[model samples]
Target: MLIFWKPRLALLAVPKTGTTALENALASSADAAIVNPPGLKHCTVRKYRRDLSGFFEQKGKRPLSLVAVMREPVDWLGSWYRYRGRDALAGQENSTAGMTFDAFVQAYLQDNPPACAKVGSQAAFLEGGVDHLFRYDRPSDLIDFLRDRLGQPVEVGRANVSPDGDLTLSRQTRAALETGRGADFELWSAL
Candidate 1:
Protein backbone atom coordinates (compact mmCIF):
# COMPACT_ATOMS: atom_id res chain seq x y z
CA MET A 1 0.00 0.00 0.00
CA LEU A 2 1.12 3.56 -0.75
CA ILE A 3 -0.15 6.60 1.11
CA PHE A 4 -0.26 10.12 -0.28
CA TRP A 5 -0.70 12.42 2.68
CA LYS A 6 -1.13 15.53 0.57
CA PRO A 7 -4.17 14.20 -1.14
CA ARG A 8 -5.20 12.02 1.80
CA LEU A 9 -5.30 8.85 -0.26
CA ALA A 10 -4.40 5.24 0.32
CA LEU A 11 -3.71 3.15 -2.76
CA LEU A 12 -4.62 -0.36 -1.77
CA ALA A 13 -2.60 -3.05 -3.51
CA VAL A 14 -4.71 -5.77 -4.99
CA PRO A 15 -2.45 -8.62 -6.07
CA LYS A 16 -2.19 -9.63 -9.74
CA THR A 17 -3.90 -6.40 -10.71
CA GLY A 18 -1.04 -4.16 -11.88
CA THR A 19 -0.74 -2.41 -8.50
CA THR A 20 3.05 -2.87 -8.47
CA ALA A 21 3.25 -0.71 -11.54
CA LEU A 22 1.26 1.99 -9.78
CA GLU A 23 3.43 1.69 -6.68
CA ASN A 24 6.60 2.09 -8.72
CA ALA A 25 5.25 5.03 -10.66
CA LEU A 26 4.07 6.94 -7.61
CA ALA A 27 6.56 5.94 -4.94
CA SER A 28 8.50 9.20 -5.16
CA SER A 29 5.41 11.20 -4.28
CA ALA A 30 4.00 8.93 -1.59
CA ASP A 31 4.49 9.73 2.09
CA ALA A 32 4.70 6.08 3.08
CA ALA A 33 5.34 3.02 0.96
CA ILE A 34 4.77 -0.43 2.41
CA VAL A 35 6.38 -2.75 -0.11
CA ASN A 36 7.49 -5.73 1.93
CA PRO A 37 5.93 -8.33 4.17
CA PRO A 38 3.31 -9.54 1.74
CA GLY A 39 0.52 -9.27 4.27
CA LEU A 40 1.11 -5.56 4.82
CA LYS A 41 1.98 -4.90 1.20
CA HIS A 42 -1.38 -6.36 0.27
CA CYS A 43 -3.32 -5.12 3.27
CA THR A 44 -7.00 -5.73 2.87
CA VAL A 45 -9.70 -3.05 3.13
CA ARG A 46 -10.94 -4.52 6.41
CA LYS A 47 -7.50 -4.33 7.98
CA TYR A 48 -7.01 -0.79 6.77
CA ARG A 49 -10.35 0.23 8.18
CA ARG A 50 -9.75 -1.53 11.46
CA ASP A 51 -6.10 -0.73 12.03
CA LEU A 52 -4.92 2.21 9.94
CA SER A 53 -7.81 4.39 8.92
CA GLY A 54 -8.22 6.19 12.22
CA PHE A 55 -4.53 7.04 12.50
CA PHE A 56 -4.46 8.53 9.01
CA GLU A 57 -7.66 10.39 9.52
CA GLN A 58 -6.73 11.83 12.92
CA LYS A 59 -3.02 12.36 12.36
CA GLY A 60 -3.31 13.64 8.84
CA LYS A 61 -6.38 15.72 9.77
CA ARG A 62 -8.28 14.28 6.83
CA PRO A 63 -10.05 11.11 5.92
CA LEU A 64 -8.21 9.10 3.30
CA SER A 65 -9.87 8.08 0.12
CA LEU A 66 -9.07 4.45 -0.53
CA VAL A 67 -8.51 3.25 -4.09
CA ALA A 68 -7.85 -0.13 -5.64
CA VAL A 69 -7.75 -1.88 -9.01
CA MET A 70 -9.45 -5.17 -9.61
CA ARG A 71 -8.98 -7.60 -12.47
CA GLU A 72 -11.52 -9.88 -14.10
CA PRO A 73 -11.98 -12.97 -11.94
CA VAL A 74 -10.90 -15.54 -14.51
CA ASP A 75 -7.96 -13.46 -15.65
CA TRP A 76 -6.98 -12.90 -12.02
CA LEU A 77 -6.89 -16.66 -11.41
CA GLY A 78 -5.04 -17.20 -14.68
CA SER A 79 -2.36 -14.73 -13.58
CA TRP A 80 -1.95 -16.64 -10.31
CA TYR A 81 -1.76 -19.92 -12.17
CA ARG A 82 0.93 -18.59 -14.48
CA TYR A 83 2.77 -16.80 -11.69
CA ARG A 84 3.11 -19.93 -9.55
CA GLY A 85 4.25 -21.95 -12.55
CA ARG A 86 7.51 -20.02 -12.85
CA ASP A 87 10.76 -21.97 -12.91
CA ALA A 88 11.91 -20.27 -9.68
CA LEU A 89 9.26 -22.07 -7.64
CA ALA A 90 9.56 -25.49 -9.23
CA GLY A 91 9.95 -27.55 -6.07
CA GLN A 92 8.05 -25.42 -3.59
CA GLU A 93 4.80 -26.51 -1.99
CA ASN A 94 3.14 -23.43 -3.48
CA SER A 95 4.36 -24.16 -6.99
CA THR A 96 2.06 -24.84 -9.91
CA ALA A 97 4.90 -25.97 -12.17
CA GLY A 98 3.14 -28.88 -13.80
CA MET A 99 -0.49 -28.01 -13.39
CA THR A 100 -2.72 -26.98 -16.27
CA PHE A 101 -4.72 -23.77 -15.96
CA ASP A 102 -7.93 -25.75 -15.55
CA ALA A 103 -6.46 -27.85 -12.77
CA PHE A 104 -5.04 -24.80 -11.02
CA VAL A 105 -8.43 -23.13 -11.10
CA GLN A 106 -10.11 -26.29 -9.90
CA ALA A 107 -7.78 -26.32 -6.93
CA TYR A 108 -8.52 -22.65 -6.22
CA LEU A 109 -12.25 -23.28 -6.18
CA GLN A 110 -11.97 -26.16 -3.77
CA ASP A 111 -13.39 -25.83 -0.23
CA ASN A 112 -9.83 -25.60 1.03
CA PRO A 113 -7.40 -24.67 -1.71
CA PRO A 114 -3.91 -26.08 -1.81
CA ALA A 115 -1.00 -23.70 -1.23
CA CYS A 116 -0.59 -22.91 -4.91
CA ALA A 117 -4.22 -21.83 -5.18
CA LYS A 118 -4.74 -20.24 -1.81
CA VAL A 119 -4.90 -16.65 -3.01
CA GLY A 120 -7.89 -14.85 -1.53
CA SER A 121 -10.49 -13.32 -3.82
CA GLN A 122 -10.60 -9.60 -4.71
CA ALA A 123 -14.11 -9.22 -3.37
CA ALA A 124 -13.04 -10.53 0.01
CA PHE A 125 -9.97 -8.29 0.10
CA LEU A 126 -11.91 -5.13 -0.64
CA GLU A 127 -14.90 -6.11 1.45
CA GLY A 128 -14.67 -3.23 3.92
CA GLY A 129 -14.73 -0.96 0.85
CA VAL A 130 -12.83 1.61 -1.21
CA ASP A 131 -13.76 5.13 -2.16
CA HIS A 132 -12.46 4.68 -5.67
CA LEU A 133 -12.14 1.45 -7.62
CA PHE A 134 -10.75 0.83 -11.10
CA ARG A 135 -10.50 -2.11 -13.44
CA TYR A 136 -7.12 -3.58 -14.38
CA ASP A 137 -7.81 -3.82 -18.11
CA ARG A 138 -9.06 -0.22 -18.25
CA PRO A 139 -7.28 2.33 -16.07
CA SER A 140 -7.80 5.68 -17.77
CA ASP A 141 -10.23 6.86 -15.12
CA LEU A 142 -7.82 6.02 -12.33
CA ILE A 143 -4.93 7.64 -14.18
CA ASP A 144 -6.94 10.79 -14.64
CA PHE A 145 -7.93 10.89 -10.98
CA LEU A 146 -4.35 10.45 -9.81
CA ARG A 147 -3.02 13.01 -12.25
CA ASP A 148 -5.54 15.58 -11.13
CA ARG A 149 -4.93 14.93 -7.47
CA LEU A 150 -1.16 14.47 -7.52
CA GLY A 151 -0.51 17.23 -10.03
CA GLN A 152 1.77 14.86 -11.96
CA PRO A 153 1.29 12.55 -14.89
CA VAL A 154 0.67 8.98 -13.76
CA GLU A 155 2.51 6.50 -15.95
CA VAL A 156 2.15 2.90 -14.89
CA GLY A 157 4.76 0.75 -16.55
CA ARG A 158 4.89 -2.97 -16.01
CA ALA A 159 6.35 -4.16 -12.72
CA ASN A 160 6.21 -7.64 -11.22
CA VAL A 161 4.25 -8.67 -14.29
CA SER A 162 3.31 -12.28 -14.84
CA PRO A 163 4.79 -14.25 -17.72
CA ASP A 164 2.83 -14.34 -20.94
CA GLY A 165 0.75 -17.43 -21.67
CA ASP A 166 -2.54 -18.53 -23.08
CA LEU A 167 -5.04 -19.65 -20.45
CA THR A 168 -7.93 -22.00 -20.99
CA LEU A 169 -10.29 -23.58 -18.47
CA SER A 170 -12.62 -26.52 -18.88
CA ARG A 171 -16.33 -25.74 -18.98
CA GLN A 172 -16.95 -27.74 -15.82
CA THR A 173 -14.20 -25.96 -13.88
CA ARG A 174 -15.39 -22.57 -15.12
CA ALA A 175 -18.88 -23.40 -13.98
CA ALA A 176 -17.60 -24.46 -10.60
CA LEU A 177 -15.58 -21.27 -10.20
CA GLU A 178 -18.58 -19.13 -10.97
CA THR A 179 -20.75 -21.11 -8.59
CA GLY A 180 -18.22 -20.98 -5.77
CA ARG A 181 -17.19 -17.37 -6.28
CA GLY A 182 -20.39 -15.62 -7.19
CA ALA A 183 -19.47 -12.56 -5.12
CA ASP A 184 -16.42 -11.88 -7.29
CA PHE A 185 -18.49 -11.97 -10.44
CA GLU A 186 -21.09 -9.73 -8.88
CA LEU A 187 -18.52 -7.19 -7.74
CA TRP A 188 -16.73 -7.14 -11.09
CA SER A 189 -19.98 -6.72 -12.95
CA ALA A 190 -20.95 -3.80 -10.70
CA LEU A 191 -17.60 -2.19 -11.36
Candidate 2:
Protein backbone atom coordinates (compact mmCIF):
# COMPACT_ATOMS: atom_id res chain seq x y z
CA MET A 1 0.00 0.00 0.00
CA LEU A 2 1.22 3.45 -0.93
CA ILE A 3 0.38 6.55 1.02
CA PHE A 4 0.55 10.06 -0.43
CA TRP A 5 1.46 12.86 1.90
CA LYS A 6 -0.23 15.99 0.77
CA PRO A 7 1.96 18.96 1.46
CA ARG A 8 0.54 22.44 1.42
CA LEU A 9 -1.44 23.55 -1.57
CA ALA A 10 0.88 24.34 -4.45
CA LEU A 11 0.41 27.44 -6.58
CA LEU A 12 1.84 26.91 -10.07
CA ALA A 13 2.88 30.29 -11.37
CA VAL A 14 2.38 30.90 -15.02
CA PRO A 15 4.53 33.71 -16.40
CA LYS A 16 3.06 37.14 -17.25
CA THR A 17 -0.38 36.08 -16.10
CA GLY A 18 -0.75 38.56 -13.27
CA THR A 19 0.97 35.94 -11.15
CA THR A 20 3.11 38.47 -9.34
CA ALA A 21 0.05 40.51 -8.46
CA LEU A 22 -1.81 37.46 -7.30
CA GLU A 23 1.22 36.23 -5.44
CA ASN A 24 1.43 39.47 -3.55
CA ALA A 25 -2.27 39.29 -2.74
CA LEU A 26 -2.14 35.68 -1.62
CA ALA A 27 1.03 36.31 0.31
CA SER A 28 -0.64 39.11 2.22
CA SER A 29 -4.05 37.51 2.58
CA ALA A 30 -3.25 33.84 3.20
CA ASP A 31 0.21 33.89 4.77
CA ALA A 32 1.48 31.62 2.01
CA ALA A 33 5.12 31.37 1.03
CA ILE A 34 5.99 31.99 -2.60
CA VAL A 35 8.85 29.94 -3.98
CA ASN A 36 10.94 31.60 -6.64
CA PRO A 37 12.05 29.35 -9.45
CA PRO A 38 15.59 27.99 -9.69
CA GLY A 39 18.18 29.84 -11.79
CA LEU A 40 16.02 32.77 -12.77
CA LYS A 41 16.75 35.51 -10.25
CA HIS A 42 13.27 37.06 -10.49
CA CYS A 43 10.60 34.59 -11.51
CA THR A 44 7.96 32.36 -9.94
CA VAL A 45 8.12 28.60 -10.07
CA ARG A 46 6.18 27.82 -13.22
CA LYS A 47 6.62 24.07 -13.01
CA TYR A 48 5.59 22.09 -9.94
CA ARG A 49 6.30 18.45 -9.04
CA ARG A 50 7.23 16.96 -12.37
CA ASP A 51 7.08 13.45 -10.92
CA LEU A 52 3.60 14.18 -9.60
CA SER A 53 2.39 13.90 -13.18
CA GLY A 54 2.63 17.36 -14.69
CA PHE A 55 0.16 19.39 -12.63
CA PHE A 56 -1.25 16.41 -10.78
CA GLU A 57 1.07 16.23 -7.77
CA GLN A 58 0.92 18.19 -4.53
CA LYS A 59 3.53 17.78 -1.84
CA GLY A 60 2.41 18.10 1.75
CA LYS A 61 1.03 16.11 4.67
CA ARG A 62 -2.61 16.36 3.69
CA PRO A 63 -4.74 15.97 0.57
CA LEU A 64 -3.59 19.03 -1.30
CA SER A 65 -4.97 20.57 -4.46
CA LEU A 66 -3.57 22.81 -7.20
CA VAL A 67 -4.61 26.26 -8.34
CA ALA A 68 -3.59 28.50 -11.25
CA VAL A 69 -4.55 31.94 -12.58
CA MET A 70 -4.24 32.77 -16.24
CA ARG A 71 -5.21 35.63 -18.54
CA GLU A 72 -6.72 35.88 -21.94
CA PRO A 73 -4.22 34.56 -24.48
CA VAL A 74 -4.19 37.73 -26.56
CA ASP A 75 -3.28 40.04 -23.71
CA TRP A 76 -0.88 37.57 -22.17
CA LEU A 77 0.97 37.08 -25.41
CA GLY A 78 1.20 40.80 -26.08
CA SER A 79 2.65 41.52 -22.65
CA TRP A 80 5.06 38.67 -22.99
CA TYR A 81 6.27 39.91 -26.36
CA ARG A 82 6.89 43.45 -25.14
CA TYR A 83 8.81 42.31 -22.10
CA ARG A 84 10.89 39.88 -24.12
CA GLY A 85 11.22 41.85 -27.34
CA ARG A 86 12.51 44.88 -25.51
CA ASP A 87 15.16 42.74 -23.92
CA ALA A 88 16.06 41.16 -27.25
CA LEU A 89 16.29 44.48 -29.02
CA ALA A 90 18.25 46.23 -26.33
CA GLY A 91 21.63 46.15 -28.11
CA GLN A 92 20.59 45.99 -31.72
CA GLU A 93 19.74 48.95 -33.95
CA ASN A 94 17.53 48.59 -37.05
CA SER A 95 17.54 44.89 -36.23
CA THR A 96 14.01 44.09 -37.25
CA ALA A 97 12.98 46.77 -34.82
CA GLY A 98 10.79 48.43 -37.41
CA MET A 99 9.14 45.23 -38.57
CA THR A 100 5.38 45.28 -38.86
CA PHE A 101 3.30 43.64 -36.16
CA ASP A 102 2.36 40.94 -38.61
CA ALA A 103 5.98 40.22 -39.42
CA PHE A 104 6.91 40.22 -35.75
CA VAL A 105 4.09 37.85 -35.00
CA GLN A 106 5.23 35.55 -37.75
CA ALA A 107 8.79 35.55 -36.47
CA TYR A 108 7.56 35.06 -32.94
CA LEU A 109 5.43 32.03 -33.73
CA GLN A 110 8.09 30.48 -35.91
CA ASP A 111 10.99 31.10 -33.56
CA ASN A 112 9.61 30.77 -30.07
CA PRO A 113 6.47 28.86 -30.94
CA PRO A 114 4.00 28.07 -28.21
CA ALA A 115 5.32 25.35 -25.99
CA CYS A 116 4.90 24.22 -22.39
CA ALA A 117 8.68 24.36 -22.24
CA LYS A 118 8.31 28.13 -21.89
CA VAL A 119 4.81 29.41 -21.32
CA GLY A 120 2.22 27.17 -19.66
CA SER A 121 0.16 25.63 -22.39
CA GLN A 122 -3.54 25.03 -21.89
CA ALA A 123 -2.99 21.40 -22.82
CA ALA A 124 -0.51 21.08 -19.98
CA PHE A 125 -2.91 22.74 -17.58
CA LEU A 126 -5.83 20.53 -18.53
CA GLU A 127 -3.73 17.41 -18.26
CA GLY A 128 -2.20 18.63 -14.97
CA GLY A 129 -5.45 17.90 -13.10
CA VAL A 130 -5.60 21.19 -11.24
CA ASP A 131 -8.59 21.46 -8.92
CA HIS A 132 -9.49 24.92 -10.10
CA LEU A 133 -8.26 27.61 -12.49
CA PHE A 134 -8.91 31.29 -11.90
CA ARG A 135 -8.90 33.76 -14.71
CA TYR A 136 -6.68 36.76 -13.99
CA ASP A 137 -8.91 38.87 -16.20
CA ARG A 138 -11.32 38.71 -13.27
CA PRO A 139 -9.59 38.96 -9.93
CA SER A 140 -12.78 38.94 -7.90
CA ASP A 141 -13.59 35.49 -9.20
CA LEU A 142 -10.19 34.25 -8.13
CA ILE A 143 -10.57 35.87 -4.75
CA ASP A 144 -13.93 34.28 -4.15
CA PHE A 145 -12.69 30.88 -5.25
CA LEU A 146 -9.57 31.19 -3.13
CA ARG A 147 -11.60 32.26 -0.13
CA ASP A 148 -13.70 29.14 -0.39
CA ARG A 149 -10.73 26.85 -0.98
CA LEU A 150 -8.27 28.26 1.54
CA GLY A 151 -10.81 29.13 4.17
CA GLN A 152 -9.64 32.74 4.25
CA PRO A 153 -10.49 36.01 2.64
CA VAL A 154 -7.78 36.75 0.08
CA GLU A 155 -7.54 40.24 -1.34
CA VAL A 156 -6.66 39.96 -4.99
CA GLY A 157 -5.64 43.35 -6.27
CA ARG A 158 -4.22 44.85 -9.43
CA ALA A 159 -0.50 44.84 -8.77
CA ASN A 160 1.12 44.17 -12.12
CA VAL A 161 1.23 46.70 -14.94
CA SER A 162 -0.53 45.92 -18.15
CA PRO A 163 1.53 45.16 -21.25
CA ASP A 164 3.12 48.16 -23.01
CA GLY A 165 2.27 47.38 -26.65
CA ASP A 166 -0.12 45.43 -28.82
CA LEU A 167 0.54 41.73 -28.32
CA THR A 168 -1.69 40.13 -30.85
CA LEU A 169 -0.27 36.94 -32.25
CA SER A 170 0.28 36.60 -35.97
CA ARG A 171 -2.54 35.05 -37.90
CA GLN A 172 -0.82 31.66 -38.14
CA THR A 173 0.01 31.57 -34.46
CA ARG A 174 -3.46 32.68 -33.54
CA ALA A 175 -4.99 29.96 -35.66
CA ALA A 176 -2.70 27.34 -34.18
CA LEU A 177 -3.28 28.41 -30.60
CA GLU A 178 -7.01 28.53 -31.26
CA THR A 179 -6.98 25.08 -32.82
CA GLY A 180 -3.95 23.25 -31.49
CA ARG A 181 -2.01 24.22 -28.35
CA GLY A 182 -5.00 26.06 -26.93
CA ALA A 183 -7.93 23.89 -27.85
CA ASP A 184 -9.10 24.13 -24.28
CA PHE A 185 -9.18 27.94 -24.54
CA GLU A 186 -11.24 27.61 -27.69
CA LEU A 187 -13.74 25.44 -25.86
CA TRP A 188 -13.89 27.93 -23.02
CA SER A 189 -14.46 30.74 -25.51
CA ALA A 190 -17.38 28.79 -26.90
CA LEU A 191 -18.97 28.55 -23.46
The model with the greatest TM-score is 1
**What TM-scores do the predictions have?**
0.96, 0.65
Q: Which stretches of candidate 2 lie over 4 Å from their true place?
A: 1-8, 28-32, 38-47, 51-61, 85-89, 92-101, 111-120, 168-173, 187-191
Model 2, span 92-150: residue lDDT tens: 54233344444544454454543211444444454545665777667778677666666
lDDT of 1: 0.90
The CA lDDT at 35 in model 2 is: 38
Instruction: Tell me, by lDDT, which candidate is best.
Output: 1
Error of 1 at 180 (Å): 0.5
Model 1 residue 121 CA deviation (Å) reads 0.5
